[model samples]
Target: MNVDGALAPAVESILRTARERTPGEDAERISVDARSFSDALADAEENGRVPLIAEVKPTSPTTNGERTDDPVELAETMVENGATALSVLTEPEHFGGSTENLRRIREAVDVPVLRKDFIVREEQLDAVAADLVLLIVRFVDDLEGLLSAAEERGFQVLVEVHDEEELREALDAGATIIGVNNRDLARLEVDLGTFESVAPVVPEDTTLVAESGITTTADVERMCDAGADALLVGSAIMDGDVGENTRRLVNA
Candidate 1:
């Protein structure tokens, strides 16, 4: 079966599983703080280096299997190398990740953690304990309501766009952090030029992040040349020596 085609159902199942795992009282009392993810990135940028958001992803829809199941160790290695933040993939079925992994990774590292998933509903956001939230432009037709609700809940939104129209909608929705994902959601293909197409349209002050298909120091340099303030890398670090590769990417 094509896993990408079943992504929506798989995500729904994961959310239901997360809700089932949480106790009634714990779920009711759980609250995210007022601090946003942007605060962490801003602080890092002020120190004169690009923020590196390293990911602890066990698997992906494209990969179709686990790259690594040890979340805590991976989180530690990322931090030890020079990652400014952590991105924990919480989508269970498609990504081979879970909320338990996210909570464990957060406890394992001190850096801010972003919940990287196809965030489509508010209740889904509450299911995972994340310092930052992601919003995919291709996933939703209405942007205004979603952006407003996310901000109201004290979550920093990383609005992800693959095309110019999506970029425009993200800015209109008041997205402070704009991520240009090179991976096309419709075809599940990656094109590095996607960043080149969208980066210029983003405001100078907005934190620009290049996501997907980045693997080497050369890729990092290319992204930096294209005006990216941060980069989200997963497979390369997960499959290689995490600490060594992370240091090369961050210090590049």
Candidate 2:
């Protein structure tokens, strides 16, 4: 509940935005006929390929400049190169993201869109047009309630965890899809071992996604060997050739 570390600023900024929203704004929601995000990852695994969830992040707290000016174009290129899903940052200010970009990317691609943001309350889920949403267990008090709320809104929740305790909380909350973030919010440092350490404890039935610190094909191979069903790559793909970099990871 006491937000701190690398996520403190983002969590603070997102809460203000969540508070400003008028409740029930999505009462007459225009539903998106979303593709199943979990199924997409599972299908990739079943077909003997590690799934990829390429991100559409323009900027981040850790980066200095904008990664791309046109998110839709970048998203299309990623999918063309075999990305299974897309994660779009929706938190502005620190992340240089917006809901407009999420909507635009979702329209440009048929793959499922993940609204990657610091979601602390159910109110934030209102008006989210994406097929999936992210919920960090460290920032949430009632993980179960928020998970239920997201599912009720017709969005699959990718419960994020940084370590063992948070992973336990996610499992207790009945999370089916889990993303192990290698970047520690406390120090903004990434250690690939974080996923490797947590992966074995996660139930085989749960879809596990390895996030952060993955850039090269070797890194992708390492994660797959460690039991990652999918990889959520951001800075690595955005900082260079989008299509080429994505292809390298996809073929890895």
Candidate achieving the largest lDDT: 2
For residue 64, model 2's alpha carbon misses the true position, in angstroms, by: 2.2
What TM-scores do the predictions have?
0.85, 0.90
**How well is each residue in 1-252 modelled by candidate 2, as lDDT tens digits?**
535445555545656675565425545543445689877876777766559999989988777789756999999999988899999998776688888899899989988889998777777776558898899887787899989978877888899998888889899899999999998776678999999999999998898999999988999999999998889999888988999888888889
| Distance from true location, Cα of 111 in model 2, Å | 0.9
Cα lDDT for residue 190, candidate 2: 90
Off by over 4 Å in 2: 2-32, 46-48
TM-score of 1: 0.85
- Which clashing pairs does model 1 show? none
The best candidate in terms of TM-score: 2
